[model samples]
Target: MINYEEILNSSVVDIKPSGIRKFFDIAEQMENVISLGVGEPDFKTPWHIRQAGIDALEKSKTRYTSNRGLIELRREISSYYKRKLNLDYSPESEVLVTVGGSEAIDLAIRALINEGDEVIIPEPSFVCYVPIVKMAGGVPVIINTKAENEFRLTAEELKGAITEKTKMLILPFPNNPTGAIMEREDLEKIAEILKGTNIIILSDEIYSELTYGNSHTSIAQIGEMQERTVLISGFSKAYSMTGWRLGYILCPAPLCKQMTKIHQFCIMSSPTVSQYAAIEALKNGDDDIASMRAEYDVRRTYVVNEFRKMGLSVFEPKGAFYVFPCIKSSGMTSDEFCERLLKEKKVATVPGNAFGECGEGFIRVSYCNSLGNLKIALSKIKEFLKENKNG
Candidate 1:
């Protein structure tokens, strides 16, 4: 047999598989599993968005777009950002369409990091940031955000993690798994700390459209910080366009130029049909976002209340479709809690440790499914908790 290990990149080999996927695989093999594990929206792409993709196909618009993406789509993205977030970018120079926000993040990290440079990541946030930073030849520096602060990365935490080697800081809010959001004041403090530094902020705002109570704020919206922030977003969560694989990155022209080079060689451009559909989503999808957000809000409330009633300590999530509840009260590690719950109750939830080490005593439960399904999952979880409660 060929020595595959000898040929593989050492860095890639060292990275472990995603912690979320293991339980998902087990659930997939089981019958009648009520999964609260995956972070995808249960909603289908809104009718108009789907229709636009269909129309594009009917018109035979299947060729590759410009390496930077279709100009019209970029322009729509520019206008949408300006109107919704008060952030401005020149479409012709500062925007690059990507396969998904995943690509945009990869491009940004690869373009910016040199070997041994340190990239600070706040967790439990997203699973991709550390590995992407490592793949880019950068050192992964982690700052474990606390549940006491609702998992928002404090300015103090950022300052503590920074050193001469620090090159990038990933800001993922409204965060995944934890469902934590950094409000304006929280972001302002972070902006202040980063004001004079060379540290680039890779702000992943994929869940921006899902925030409830207060509007989502980007560090890019802060004046001095805008020049250093690469803002990434996609249609996956908000518009239910996950399979369409369309996303974009907005950065200062200089950074955009570098990121586009990586994107050009690696991806060339996002899918043409998806680009057309994304344009429709940006222009005519406000009602769709509102409808979905309202529905999620109901599910969010129900899930939080149910978890609390079970005597589990769950921080109220203000955004995203997830709730991270402390499983410590059940006297089990996150992994044990999830495994036992899956085996006994037939409900699947991702262990919080999938997101980071700080997630050890918690489990992430996504509320992206229907209210009826969530109710069933919650009841199953309640039964599991009762059986496993700490003495």
Candidate 2:
């Protein structure tokens, strides 16, 4: 035998597959599966945004862009933050266009993490933070945010997780899986704790535009925290531009310089057509965002209400399009609950354990599908609950 396992990097090999995709893959193989699994938005890219890409192709703008991305797109990114978030960033030095928010995250981790450095991550959050930290040779110190706290990372939790070796703290607000958001007051508390520390923050705010009643707030917006925070966001969730593969990073010039080095060697630049399209998104896509958010709000309310009526304990989410509902009453582990639900009811939903150990006994349900589909899926789940009450 060739013994490929011996040749492959053990660090990469030993990592477990993403728990979010397990049931999603299973549903893909079967017939008539109603999935609330994947976190993708169901909306199409707006016509004008798509037209911009088409225009780029017609004008033959297919060559590689600057290593930092087209200056025009970068300026738009800067302007968007300035106009929308009241945060100032220089397009030339402090902004980097990335392949996606995921890439920006990876670059930030690789740029800042030294071997044995500890990264404090709040969970029931995204799955990527831990693995990314591990790959960068950093230790992941996890703080499990309680359900009673609406899954927000409190200052007490952040204080307790900090150590001398702590290098970065990832703030995944408008968080995935759980739809928790940290308002301005929440950010202030966290900023207060890090006042004198050397700790940097990796704030992933990809879903910033999707907040329910209240607006989204970045920790960087608080006092001097902007100097220490790397803000990663993009056109994915807000503009429904996931497949376009465009995201950006905003931070201090020093950090951007280091991250750009990694990006230059690993990814020459983000997609040119996508960048052209993104400029248009930043310039004129506010209406699109508003429309999408309104529709998502409707779906969000419906899903949470339905789950509550099922007698399941659900943390009412105020941001993002997901609802994390506790399925402990079903007397099944998260994985078992998801698998049985998929097999018996033909409904596919991700187990909450995929996000972190603390997510066990809950299921993360995306309301990103159509209203009709959601109604059908929720009804099927209700049937599953009645049929298998304690199994």
Candidate 3:
């Protein structure tokens, strides 16, 4: 009766719901589902980190922090980058704590984009980039990174996607669904191409600590690229602090000043207890990260091998906790493959196209569950494939 459609924002209305959550919701209603659809870590928040939050509550440290966040937390973040990657930032000026890495990304996009500006994004990567770009009145320019290249955005791909209107390049390495990583050599080529451009690199390194075999590399670490890069990261994947909702951004002082204003108006401060916990995580969480990364490495190998054995052409993921295996052999679209697999076999997976159009024939399977669950899910998938072929 109330014409809510006419009153609602068209831009928001036009955006599609996340493809990743489609099968996940279906799996939730069904009985005995083995779902590998989400990227959440199955690990608990380390006790010391949890204790820090509890300690903060007991001490009544519940008031809002500065719009930029607690100075001590910012300092710990600064110390973290310095210790881990030999990167430096002035805690007083360049670091801003955020609600999560997702919010940090939103703040960066909103602060930087004006009407009709174009942002280059590589896919199949994270689902949030394109929608966020559009919400900021920025055009989404997608470059489909190929499986042959391990889904890394090649310099040629970046160079070709650039135009006079391009303002930002979202480098989502150690990427989400694909588990792709851009090595230092790979990033240097990208740096060379953008050397003289005004395009800002929004390097979403939320999965940085999860890389296996080789350590993660940020585009910000390449040459003088740091001056033009807005580095975003969080404790979700690394320290299993997802529900704690703490993340931070590091960039040049000028950009930091503007992004902080956006964060100030939209979110005056991040969670105080979470900030306290993050400080402890930054201080004493190396062993926790190492142990978690080691466990994920084992799972990654197992998942990749299992998918390959099922006769799916699986790209060996070097980062993140997912395996994007090509399911074209089943003669089904990604959506059909996942839907049928879910209904018939009781195992849930995300269709690759949820990440982008290029992900059409692939399926993203997260290996975040226990080895026992993974074995069960993988076996069910193998059975599904056999039935598909026989039918």
Worst 10 residues of 1 by lDDT: 382-391
Q: Residue 62 CA error for candidate 3 (Å)?
A: 0.3
Stretches of model 3 off by over 4 angstroms after superposition: none
- TM-score list, all predictions: 0.99, 0.99, 0.99
- Model 2 ranges off by over 4 Å: none
Q: Which runs of model 1 end up more than 4 angstroms from their true locations? A: none
Looking at model 2, residue 253 earns an lDDT score of: 99
lDDT of 1 by residue, 1-391 (tens): 9999999999999999998888988898999998788889999999999999999999999999999999999999999999998888999999999999999999999999999999999999889999999988999999999999999999999999999999999999999989999998999999999999899999999999999999898899887999999999999998999999989999999999999998999888889999999999999999999999999999999999988888888899998999999988777889989998998999989999999999999999998899999888888887787777667
TM-score (C-alpha) between model 3 and the true structure: 0.99
Evaluate all candidate structures by whole-model CA lDDT and list the values in order. Answer: 0.93, 0.94, 0.93
Clashing pairs in 1: none
Least well predicted 10-residue stretch by lDDT in candidate 2: 19-28
Residue 298, candidate 3: C-alpha displacement in angstroms: 0.8
lDDT of 3 by residue, 1-391 (tens): 8899899998998899998777878888899988798889999999999999999999999999999999999999999899889899999999999999999999999999999999999999889999999999999999999999999999999999999999999999899999999999999999999998899999999999999888888888889899999999998989999999988899999999999999999999999999999999999999999999888888889999988888899889999899999999999999999999999999989999999999999999999999999999999999989988934
TM-score of candidate 2 relative to the true fold? 0.99
Q: Give the higher-lDDT candidate: 1 or 2.
A: 2
Clashing pairs in 2: none
Clashes of 2: 0
